[model samples]
Target: MNIPYAIPECRVAHLVERHHDHLVVPVRLDAATGCCPECGHASRSVHSRYHRQPADLPLSTSQTKLRIEVRRFYCLNPTCRRRIFAKTPTDLLAPHARRTRRLGEAQARVGLACGGAGGARLLAHLHMPASRATVLRLVTRMPMPDTPAPIRVGIDDWAIRKGSRYGTIVVDLDRHRVVDLLPDRTAPTVAGWLERHSSVALVAWDRSTEYARGASLGAPQAQQVADRWHLLTNMRQAVERWLHGAHARLRSLPLLPGSTVRPARRNRAFARSTTELEAAAQSRMRWQVVYDEVRHRHAAGKPLLAIARALGLARATVRKYASAETFPARLPHGAGPSLLDPHVAYLAGRIDEGSENAMALWREIREQGYPGTSRQVHRFVAERRTRPVRSGRKPRSAKASASEPPGSETLLPPARQLAWLLVQPTSVLNESEAAVVSRVEQDDTARAVTGLARRFTALVRAAGKGNPVADDRDAAADIEAWITKARTCEAPAIATFASGLEADIAAVRAALMEPWSSGQAEGQVNRLKLIKRQCYGRAGLNLLKRRMVLAA
Candidate 1:
């Protein structure tokens, strides 16, 4: 019988046995003589013979095991220390190994692609039985190809366990491949690795102090470039903070003339549907009972804890009620901002003009860039119709008095939404959004912040697109000018944010001047997360590193 071509060094002598799910083939080495390991002497004289069993790759959907008759040869040289040496098939199987080299190679590849448990399941599907631990061992034993020194690199941190432990991933930006994964996200760990790769010319990263310090210590000659996306994101967060602080002022601003004005009447139907009044009354009654009990207990000279235990209240609650202060009003949770906000005024106008059909209003707004449901419009219209009108003489205009600031009645969008609006290019905003943004820009503080934000965005776009404005000296000067403006601007939040940028000015300047970015590094981190999650977070760092480098 002829053996398969995969194990060509051995020829099949005969079929030894056949079972329901497995086939056993007895084979022998085709070579007439074997070479001695110690002296490289070829010997044909056999000392003894033994049967060896090793598992081979599956044959025709059935498990195949080879029962080979291996021979032990006596050394012909008199001076040789070894008397007898066993003949082993180097191409078929390693010494003392239970499986063929080809089968082990396939298992290792499967382990690299899918992690241990996943790979085991996959192998089972292919009728190649292997355990998760075996697959993991094969993966760890797999060799890694040597990589060249990186000239342009990006570094970023990824969570091993989010909010608890994190590690760093280093990427070769020019090659667009991950180079190494450090054990921890500390300065010493990163610095130790960077010190070994002195050929790195440019290092791109986010505003992480640990990375900055490590890069400076290890690769002082390398230019450090901060990510433009991170810089813009930080600036947006600062703008949002300032907007949140100014929310009260924005709430008091008067609406512009001819703007859709909401009447100050209670919605009886909405109140009934929500049971809001009943909830408030129950809360008030509960708090009042607690307050009366606490005051009585305090007057009786009972300790706070005793009063708490007697009344089944927490000590903190009892102390709060015992304190002589006015009852604090419970504020209702605010509704989240909706995409339909910009068109709500237009919807109200259409309803006032006697087009009370909600579906028609939804279609009109859809044409005007409203990305919301007709159900939301229907709810709005239904509530508006149930407003309780005042039964008296004709009311005065709902517009604010001249003493009030113009546009005060128009509440600004939430901080995040307002920040998004401010950062958006004016050409993209609809008529209503543009007007709102224009009104906000009229404020000196808001105008200063918006101007700085726009300038920074232009710089980033220019750098990303390789425009001429990204010239190192020119970009540096522009950044300095913006920082000066920020410091002098009336917005304290903007000034604080600028101060932080000034401290990291070198990295920030590199961000504007150099074309390299941490974008590629960030992408690698995301890929790492995917691989980590695939293993159900059971694979260790060494196993994960092998998968990342080899799989890439």
Candidate 2:
């Protein structure tokens, strides 16, 4: 049977073999002269012939294998390193390759789309089985398309092993593609990469001192722009710190005349269970014994290492205990296995359905495979029965006036929540949230910080839209005004933040004026994380880089 499309530059000679799962077709190249690879000279003199078999793309549901009759030819030119050469079909297969070029291309596409294991599984389903390693090999061997040096780029670090190891990623913000991945986040490493690609003009990055130094050293001509998101984040953190510092004063402030203050609700789930309480007590006793020993030894002028050796504790632990003024609180052991855990959902459903009798529930669970005694179920039920139900009326102090507005009796939320509200625009807040903002603004420090935060937010928003507040000078003036107000405010948190902003004033100004940002680079980092997780964290740096560049 004739098979014209079986392989390039070859025709099927005959059906050599057939099996239940696959078929083998013997094919021969149309007689022709091939160029000598070493000298680029065409030669037709036949030297030898041999059969070579290679796997091809699946034919319908069965695998197809091509058995080709290959030939050897003698070099015709005398100066062409005169010798014999194999006449393999270059377009059909690469030298010594076990699969056809088309099949390899298909496998590579699978690898590119789904990665290693996923690609292997997909190929197997498509009747083109290949191992995960093979798929990755094909992907790595695929040539990457060349990209020119980017003009505007963003640089940021991603963790290889979080907190211990990190690498840098450079992205072309204009084209929205990855430029390259650096092996380390060090200044010299990034600087070296930047020096090689001298086309970089503007570099937007986070407020990392290492990256700042690298950008300066590598691409000194490039203007560095701080990330807007990071700037806002820093400002928010400062506001939170200020609020934390003023927590006591804020708590003592009067909500209304004659109003009393109530303590915040405690998390019942966070409370230690009976078993955990016992474990914590034992742990505390053990730590106390160690702490007393360390203190005694330290008082006797024993070295930390000597104390550690004598006590069989780590030197750091010994030093920590020696310097500590009081015994550290022991953390409670985590919840252990319980008979009720497996039946918790069932118990909840039963309670919701009005089955409140612990005895009946216990019997029902027993029928469903529970082994616990009825007494345990009764205790769980009793706890649930005694749990407090929150009332609609907000808790208030007796000193608060009875004439206070409805829903105005509650004390302010935690400082963090209050800071979050302050960060958001008042226009987007609902009535209650707006009221909270008003109450917070009544505090002189909060009000001043809130105003400055809103103005900075507006500046950032305007810069994002390419319509910054006036020109760069006016924008600088606005920043200066905000900083001045912040530094003078009663809130120490805001003042501390302002001092930091003053130190990085140039980067902050660039952040508010420059159109460039590390937004794209951050997005690519997220993409890298996803790819890393998909590979189950087994891929190395080189493999990850290859995948990212080719996939990008």
Candidate 3:
């Protein structure tokens, strides 16, 4: 029979013995002399021949094994480590390995694609059975790939533990591949990596002080482009901050079409119609008082730490209250419509009919297709009991019954939501959203802030259009004019944000002119997050770095 497998510089005498689902082929080495792997000395004197069995790729439907007659050679150089060495073919097989180079490589690739246990199952189906541990070992043992030096790199930070630990990922924007994953996001680490890669001509990153300082220290000649996405994000956050002070106005707007708008509460009073809302409103009023006091103390030249200790509040809380331009309301949790919404009318009717037993009320609502728990019903009845209305009188529904004046109920769109509606393109807004935005813009302060925000958005987006206007002094002049206008705006947040831009004016200008962005690095960080979650607690940074860098 023809040899099932071939080996160069060796003679294969195939004696195909198909016994019990195994294919065995015998082969012999053709070379007269074998070199000692350690000493590199060629010795023709053979000690003794031995039968060696090593697994190979499956042949047809059966597992294949190579039974080779190999000779051990004595190391001629006495200076070298004294011993007999096997005539191992470095190209065909690794020393002491039970599989061929090709087979091991295939298994490693499988391990890379499907981690550990998954890879083992896949390998078994492919007729190349291996344990999950073996597959993982193969993956870990694989060498790191050598990529060409990067020219323009994008860098961004990824959370290892959100809000606590973070690491930086660098991507080659031109090649669109991850260059390296730093262990930590710090100035020294970033600078050290960039210093080694002198070929880097540009570094694109978010407006992080560490990265900016690092790039300046390591690659002073390279142009640093602040990411445009981060710029727009900062601008949106500023708008949101400004809107926080105008939250009452937002609540007053007749935005929701079918819903009733509640009469606006004046002077932070706890005069809400419902007991639950009244409690919530009272809580807000209490916090608002604290906020006012904190600001008063700060204005009196008291330190934040001292004020925090005096008021029994955290320093961070005191600082936030002190710096806020207006009282920031903590919107009630579960602000969305409740499960009891559809059955509110039925519950209220049963209550009016003298069915005060919470259990009886819950059963009635449940039979009427209410999915909410009995606890919700109990809470609803408890609130009604606290109200001073006549016992026989009909209770108002949670939404305020139709007997109340039209527009007596309102839902406040979050400041973040309002900021997005203002900054985003008008063409994308739905009819209702467009109408609300139109009303919002009618306010003088909202109109001014919105105009500046839209202009900044356009200027940043224009960079993607390859507009020469962004590259010229015209963009600079326009941005300067916008900043000047923003500084004079009634919104303190917008003015503060403008001051920030003025401080980092150089990078802001580069963001408008340069097309390169940290977007690629952000994409890689997303991929890294996927890989991290897959292996989650099972792998360490070494394995994660290997998988991210080498797998790509």
lDDT of 2 by residue, 305-407 (tens): 9999888898757755665456544322233567767887788777778666779999999999999798777655544442322443332222122423333
**Top candidate by TM-score:** 3
lDDT of 1 at 50: 98
Q: Provide the lDDT at 275 for model 1.
A: 61
Q: Write the per-residue lDDT of candidate 3 for residues 416-452, one digit (tens) a residue.
A: 7889988988888986677667778767898888889
Candidate 2 overall Cα lDDT vs. reference? 0.78
Mark the 10 consecutive residues where model 2 has the least summed lDDT: 263-272
**Model 1 spans > 4 angstroms off:** 1-4, 15-18, 258-409, 468-470
| lDDT (tens digit, per residue) of candidate 1 on 1-552 | 554555658888885578887888889899989889999999999999998888888877778889988999999999999989989888898889998888898888998888889999999877677999999998999898799989999999999988679999999999999899998989988888889998988899888889999999889999999998998888887787676556555555555656554334321121122365568679988887778878888989999899998998877567556652434333232344667668767877886886766788899999988887887786666555433234442211221132233443465666677887887778889877777777787677787788887777777767777773636788779889889888987777789888988988999988877778999989988889889998898878988899999989
Q: What is the C-alpha RMSD of each candidate to the true structure, in Å?
A: 9.7, 9.1, 6.0
Return the number of clashes found in candidate 1. Answer: 7
- TM-score-wise, the better of 1 and 3 is 3
**What lDDT does each candidate get?**
0.79, 0.78, 0.79
What TM-score, over all chains together, does every model reach?
0.76, 0.73, 0.78
